[model samples]
Target: MKSALKKKNLVVLKVKDVKRDKELYLHQREAMMALDQSIIDKENNRFAGLIVLPTGGGKTETAVRWVLKNFINQHKKVIWIAHRRELIEQAFESVEKNAITALIDKRKHFNCRIISGEHGSASTIERNDDFIIASKDSLYRGLHHLEEKWLKYHKEVFLIIDEAHRATAKTYRKIMESIDKNAKKFQVIGLTATPFRTAQYEKGLLKKVFKNDIVYQVSLRTLISRGILAQPILKTLQTYINVAEDVSEEEAQLIEKNDTIPPDIANFISKNKVRNNRIVQEYIDNKDEYGKTLIFAVSQTHAVVLNTLFHERGIRSEYVISNGTDLFGKGIISDSNKEKIKRFKENALDVLINVNILTEGTDIPDTQTVFLTRPTTSEILMTQMVGRALRGEQAGGTKNAYIVSFVDDWQNKIAWITPEKLYVGQGVWQDCENNPASFRRLLPLKQIEQFAKIADDTIDTTELEKIEFIKTVPLGFYSFSLEKTNEDGSTFNKSCEVLVYENNKTSFEKLMDKLTAYYSIPDAKGAKKLAKIFADAEDLSVISFLASFGFYSSNDSPTINLIDDVKDIVSHFEINRTAPPYIEFKEREQIDIRGIAQKVYDMELGGKKKKAYIDDVWERNSFLQAYFNHKKLYFRKAIDTELLKLEEPELYSA
Candidate 1:
């Protein structure tokens, strides 16, 4: 019965449309036509330009519809390039709508095929399709080794580079150069949400690859505020992870030397800032409080590690990463695999962790929490991650979304959010570090206190004070926190932080307080009975039960798992099987019992003598055997077959 109910709930979440008004505008249509004209005009010559549309702003559809219109008229060849396999598949599926419309235009139309490594023709040189949706790697390979006739015949080609910010990359650029040099008139257009170039992007090879041309940008904030997209309630949590001095030094070296991060940073961040994966893990564990989650990791390895961690905690989660062509020319993620991702999104997978693949073009509306496991210096990266969670509104009137960032490393580099101008297209915080007076200043303590006090007044102050145990701490000048929890065995103990103006503390606090009151009502409140139970015997479960009702205005939650919850609630907090750290920490002043037992086992098992015989045949090998025995004690466990057979070997004898 329980399994059936869970499955049914999953089905509803998959099919439901969180956003009611899904429509495109005249300006959007005009922009599509303008891009088509730009493409046709560039067919006379190649032009480098970017279309900066927010996520769900119909960028892919716009490109597809333009192709349908232009292809029917001029029979111009179109090659759509996607960076990732999931993106390529998504574009192909989305273009089908346009293809269906194209069928209505005439009796029969030009062929539009998905020319990926999986479904398309072996060679992309002579494809007769009007539209060829290809993965960047696959398309790049096919273009790299093009036949003479294929290049000569393909005169009027329109190349649409999705996630165009990455077009400056060598793989895409190499392909672009080939097509441009070979074809008569090749048009190039890049699409992305965030496009900012540091020295490398601006004056470096990117400048040569994609000249200064950004044609149009319709930002997420604008669409949401204008009611075109769902208005996202931006909930920010600044989780501080505390690592030991030694670990911190080691981690810093790893990041600085390698330009990559790991998942253990979650433990470090939680130790100092909030907790493991902070509010993200909580949301995953607590189904009633949080709808769905999208965790954005810093690297592919980190994403894999996070996925493992989520599975260990018994949470159903999936990960998406960028795949490149290898020597034999194969895509890392295929079309069927891309469909699996779409299915995961379609069904309400509790959590979906991605590296950089889903940052730009993928859409998953029910993702209420955006967990940032890695911190980037780019505001573009931050904006892209935040955009993923802002897709649709929650039924519980949660308009905005939640973002938990690991800023233990890049605190100074983060750009503060400006509510005033966050939604405006192409307006981002100027580099405050480079030019002083750009970064906003922190408000006075008195102002913050007054703001909190005012926030205390707006809501049910009594009820809020009742749950005052759930306290919030400001991360810095522009960030504040809100703590929340639910009665369904899930606890949100960490701070709910946000990025806003320092002086706007009062406004932010009021918003937080109102949110706290809204969610504080427990789902199943048998408070009277629980109170009686607590009074009778001071039961910890009673207090824990009450704590479950604990709520704050913050948008994130940490899903409570068996390991963490058992440790928190049990009278004796200890691991049953005793991991290394646990045993060592418990017996700090006592004897090393485990070590001694291991030593004895080593001696009894003829530890290194077994291997030493292989290396030193002529020696009076006692000395070598003793050294081997000592070394082997640390790694190998000792076993006695005869003793086990006599004592309790029924299962072991097999």
Candidate 2:
């Protein structure tokens, strides 16, 4: 009768039991696997590297998968560091969801303990734990708690950094140094859209800490071509005249001193009668072309002025600035910022305006247009700001994005966002470094002859092709004109065709090429292959397969041996999309260590808990390999006086 009852109670299980996302796109999988391989090949926990997945290209998911396969399933521990709460929350969510799905895939169970500033209480991450995702600040604050020797319980502790380009920050340095002194061996991996900030402090720090590790990298172009990102359409809205030229030399100095446009230009771009009128009218006119937009403003006041102008023009928009100043110019609560972000994401708002906050790790895939009212010189800032709109929409149809940028004609620059180099039309791009012929520079801009041609009414087709704007010439006016030399050897315009020196290129080409250059490919062939991959597949990091060959530098051209290494890695990617060597993060079921610890605590205190006891429980748990090295005294003093918090919630307050 019991047997019959058991048989009758059998629950039919479907093949796809857990909610698994579509198979990771090719590049995503490759990046995860490559980073996993690099970590595993580590002889003794000195593995530090970076993966350059374009923003919104699911770097979080890729990193999460690596942690699950490499650390979680293997019973190892992971520390994921990111800057923003949103980034941390998203990262933790990805890890929790995907890691659990992975465990479910193997019919295994492991309590994935994730502690972060967002929600993870100060619960002790016991010996047999899974992952810990923390904001950079929280990680810094909790470095002492993180220093507990948990590695003896697993193979290695892993530090996965988001926005890895900021690796040189003091917080990360402290955490790394803490781990270093604790004798807790760890593998450090960084995720970033860009690697180097400058050739000095940032470059050195990244190279030294990551061991010059470019473990997995997909060219940005490949990401777009693979449909991993949207292709951006760019238009340069020139101001017609340089604002500095319009003002006196003293006024130019004053503008520079104030770090803002002179009152005249500010009023023009801001609340002035003529320019503001033109801006609103043009924006309304182009409403059909550009979809939901994000305007990056120069200042708080500037953002407000623009917001008012937008509202007056009936654009159905909202602005969310970081500061608490109300729209009416009086103080307002800032708590609604998150609500505003939520509404914006839900498409309840047609346009979002902000000052300086929507740059790093902010992903709004549905954003169709990004307007630059503020320009910056830092390539990192510009890249981040521009990349915000490059994320493909969730529904995913046409992948065209647009960037409408304004140039400050008077200063011969843009206000807040300035691209160092760009592939402009008519077969030309300015020298990004501002040194036209500086041969000492490491990254020279690669040239593409016959990139584009300007049409002429007077000149012949062949002559039109020859007529091109001079590189690095300040914006406004200049052109190559067909001229005939007089007998006196002086040349005059015979068939002059004017070319506006507007630094505008089809967005896809320059963005793809610039990101491709980040890969440090061996030769132009690799770049071309990467470009084709970007053009054809959403999985552009097929070139990342070559990263395993130790091609971390563009100067290091691939040799015969390296080419073979590339082929070998390619074969691996083609077959084993999971972990390499037949062991895909094994299916071993884990003991309910957290459950056991929690239960013990419930028994020890009845209804109360101590942070020290909770933290030291891992040190006492005999299930771990570290149990042998356990301190009997520490176990007895479960609620060690050294522990600061009195309850379980305090353990993960970081």
Best by TM-score: 2
lDDT per residue (tens digit) for residues 1-654 in model 1 = 223212221110111122232345644766776775665555547676677776556677776666656654365677788755446656755554455433224424555545454554326344454566776666665664443535567876777888665565556777787888887777677777654342332243334555636667666656665554545433333343433234455565444333344556544442332344554466655555556677766566666767776787777777777686322122256565476578667764677876656665555666666776665533334556676765544222235555544334232222233321233233332222121111112222322232234244354323222211112222222222111234542212221122222233344345334323322232224323433444545456543543443422232221112222222221110100110111001112221223333444455535476445323321343222221221222112121222232345353423
RMSD of candidates 1 onward, in order:
27.0, 30.8
The global C-alpha lDDT for each of the candidates, from Candidate 1 onward, is 0.46, 0.50
**Candidate with best lDDT:** 2
List candidate 1 segments past 4 Å from native: 1-22, 25-27, 36-49, 55-58, 72-75, 82-90, 96-98, 102-125, 133-144, 147-149, 163-185, 194-215, 219-221, 229-385, 392-399, 406-654
Q: Write the per-residue lDDT of candidate 2 for residues 354-438, one digit (tens) a residue.
A: 7767775455667888887765543345666676777754335238777776554442222222332322211111332222211
TM-scores for candidates 1 onward, in order: 0.40, 0.44
In model 2, the number of clashes is 20
